[model samples]
Target: MDTCALFHRYWALASESGYGDDLSGQIRRSHGRRPQHGSTANVYHGTFIPNGLEVAIKTFPSTLSGMGDGSEVLAGLKCIFREVHIWSKLRHENIVPMLGMSKDFECTISVISAWMPMGNAYDYVQNTNNDPRPLLRDIASGLGYLHGHELGPVVHGDLKGLNVLVSSDRRALLTDFGLASMNTSTFNMTVEAIRGGSYQWMAPELLDNCVATTESDVWAFGMTALELFTRAVPFPDCHSVANVVGSLILGRLPPRPTQESTQFRLTSTWWEICTSCWRRDPSRRPTVDEIAERVGRAMYDTAPASFTASSHAYAPTMDTMQSRLSFTGDGPRSAPITDNDNLLPCATLSGLADKILSLSFSPDGTQIASGSANGLICHWDVHRRAQVGPLSRGHQHWVRSVAFSPNGQWIASASYDGTVRTWDVHNGVQIGSSLQGHQGKVFSVAISPTGGGIASGSADKTIGLWDVQAGKQVCALVGHTDKVQSVSASQSRIFVSGSHDKTVRLWDARAREPVGRPFEGHTGMVWSVVFSPDGRQVVSSSQDGCLCVWDVRNSSRVRHRLEGHTDEVTSVAFSPCGRRLVSGSMDSNVFVWDAQSGARVGASLRGNAGWVRCVAFSPDDGRQIISGTEGGSICIWNERIH
Candidate 1:
């Protein structure tokens, strides 16, 4: 309602530099500072002497001006309306003010706003000796006003420390509405608009569905509070954006800064508000008004005298803050240093034919089950390092994936023959009739945490949830537009899938429906996806020659992208403790990466003689890494950090 009125008032002066009547000398970029990238535009520093206004100019790149003349450039036009019309009407001390806009004949749109010389809140906290209590209060006030504005409840789709600018007076003003969506209950942006920036501050629902609400804003506010206190990004414990999303989806909260770092002594009252704002159920999260009240009380309880409402007669100088500040840029923190050495082959089992598609260790750590290219399923005794029995008969085509049931009593296998089969572990005998329904190759299979359902992802671009006991399809999940490559069932009812579509998706076992928006980031086909032992994160291998760790709770963001393999990453698995990750690739190497930091734990394991098709961690601990090569030789490497 509020946005429409602003759009109507400025319709006559659309795309004109004099629309706001604040136009001054031609703004020129002279010694511009580092730019802050958004989904649509980049904000750069510029000065316009016409009004003596030191401002930041957000310029929309012409590339997004869709091909064709005038009207065809809908994206560019919408961005203009958002900044010049909607944002310009918003007037509040806590909200960044839009001064003017200019659109050239070349289709470049630029929106100018008064710049805050003190920098962003993140930098202020990092570089200044100033207390963050006032900044936090200012941020809360700004967010509250935006959510309850007289015009409309504008959902600031992207809220983080960088978007919260610090004025010369040490006040936080909410800025950057490039991702803002107005008058909509659910905000959905295109996939191209999803890149750039860490998603640590996004709410779970917003990450999963691209749907941002006022409640979601409250969630992000909580994250910003954590950032203020920690002087680090929210979910700093996570190694990647993918991991952060997984953690949120699984209801995992970021660790308290006080517990993890010695930077600040975070009080209990502040922590309480932070956790309350992160409640998984959006309905349970505190409203922005309620949050503002609580933050005010926290500030009062902590320091009452530091916060006083008034405008100084002269513009404040950046004396104390900028003098101590120094930074190149911001990104996901690096992994802690750990052991880095190539794993040596301790043993090798050689007997099978061509490529080994899948492998898994028994739950008890005594045995391993592997599916081969020729549809042969074999079992091995770990201690003896030998096959327990002869290869068993199964699917007519290649067996693409294999998994041991939670109880370790059965093994599930998916094959190119378009069927799923279960086999008893103790005896090489089929458990029941073939589970059929898929119209294309069944590439991956996973046993549910409850051991009740067996999930399979197939070339049909559908997911099948089958009842393990009945051996029948329960329901079909149709979401991925390309072939489904991998499936992993979390300890809970949630299951995740990777696809040739270059996306990962989450599904609820009980609801038989998709959970949230697809986790879209990979540029190549996703070959494998598996959940961590705790179900807080997911690891996926892709044809793009990298391993991606995604946060299961926050389904839309990729937390980490581990690159090193020379070719496609074929398989990925988590250690028993969920602290380490092992991946095999077409490069004939097996690599281990730290689950927390997304850092490669050690050098690539290099004893294999051919392309490494599959890898599995020993169920006992991560002491041993087992990998099966294209030539059907299973190499066992010791994973001790040396």
Candidate 2:
């Protein structure tokens, strides 16, 4: 029979039998060698018949007869097809380019892609003298492209050294999209099927929730970096998967390699980057862009061989080593501010049991209240730089937010326990029973300027108006379609709420209804919101890494779009004078911006050991800026006017 006729016959037979053995045979395996085995698929070195070019043919086990139940086989086929569809659309130098596909392979399908002669990252790095920094940079660049794709962010469900292939030119290209997920409708794999990946590289949250996200991918990237550096899997000491899972659950990351290697040494700076990616809170994990920048800088700024295990031996440039001393006790408690244009580190406040998630200054600015992941709220005397009273403890879960009442006598705290509570600042004790109305975790709380009322945003997608004196919920303001992340009350009766739905809404407390059309501009979840000192404008920070200033009087009008942060802007606030804005981000840096022109005021303020969760300007005069970080320490900075 003719070649075209033979191809048609094989296609028909494969479709009928749910097998593609005849079609797959067209790509002859190189010397009939055994295929390289993987968790989901086996890759065979082969030559494409049509193009007469070398290629890698990846086949799944489900393509074979009797591999599993009919439904299971069907799911496997769907996953393979989904991967092909997604991979075909991606085009990047560091990402493996798709060639073609063989249909009905043995009863499933096979993916064809460019063959990498040098093999995977782990094997290549182990056998060759090639510096791994370039390969690491390639991986980061590829991952960043996938995340920042124009269509939608694609999450590589599994990222490990094995999935990174090195071409003949020693360029690392990311492969294995079988477990990837995209925001588009092309992804149809069941959560259970796609959730399973290499355990040692998985994020802690993924083990419990079984949901793969970009943040989880970042976690895996950190593990992949470890693998490339050590030439072994993550947690090499753990003999079994259960041990690795347990360690990750307890927030234990892979220990830093003590022994230095001639091939590549893991410096303290690189170790810091890896740990940042492994932060317990996924939202606090550094973005791929930030990772790429750091890795790129390290590649160019310092030679790998020059680094030593001793923290003091390697001295990176000031620009590269933005802040080697962390407030988390890694070094000196406070470092002198090196740049005149940046905020000067004046004091470092420590003692929180866990990461500080929220912070609020007293009306007089003499005291500060901080909420922690350990469910405790601590009061600090700003001048004394010490805890003022006993820790306030009532919430059973994470304290997400805290706010001081206008009178400076009471502090309102919102928690993940689905409750908001009031505490007496003087005694640091819960004043009443937990105020419970929301059906979900309360993320933020703001007291009215008069201190008589309180507003709270919750995961329930509803804003609660609470009567502080009565200690009860007054009404539920419903409008948001997703989790309400933040809420702020203006001097008037106006209140603003930002939600995961990617919109900001204004509410009139007196009427208990929305004031105008939702202020819509952000493309990601709104993480924080606050009103200007005059209450005429609203400032919001979002996961999109941009802040929006909305005119309260004209809700639909966005006054300014401030963009500088390279990662999720976790929190933002206006200076007491309302002339400037301060923002903290998962990038571990704080920035000051001109409130009027939406321009960055000075260099990024750096020192936080982890994600900066909350930033606030002193209500007294805005001369001091305090930022709380996921490292469980607070940094007080003197704002130097440029």
> What's the CA RMSD of model 1 in angstroms?
25.8
Q: Report every candidate's CA lDDT.
A: 0.71, 0.77
Q: How does model 1 fare in lDDT?
A: 0.71
Question: How high a TM-score does candidate 1 get?
Answer: 0.46
Worst 10 residues of 2 by lDDT: 314-323
What TM-score number comes out for model 2?
Answer: 0.55
Q: List the residue pairs that clash in candidate 2.
A: 18-107, 19-106, 19-107, 20-104, 20-106
Task: Score residue 256 of candidate 1 by CA lDDT.
Answer: 68
Best by TM-score: 2
Tens-place lDDT per residue, model 2, 1-642, is 133343344345434543222345567667767789976788888887764557898887544355566555555555666677678778887899887667535544677788886689988777433446667888998999999988799998989998999864346999998888788644334434467789999999888866799999999999998888788898988999889988987888777886465243567777888899999999999999999877754542233121111122221111111122235534233333233122212122332135678999998999889887668887876775655666687888778999999989999999989999999988778888889999988999999989999999998899999998898999999999888999998889999999988999999999988988999999988999999999888999998999999888887678999998877898999998999899998777788888999988756766524458899999989888888765445767765432
Best by lDDT: 2
Task: Return the TM-score for each candidate structure.
Answer: 0.46, 0.55
Mind giving the per-residue lDDT tens digits that candidate 1 earns over 519-616?
98898889889899998898899888888888877866789989888778888999989988889886767777778998875456654235677888
* Candidate 1 regions with alpha-carbon error over 4 angstroms: 1-352
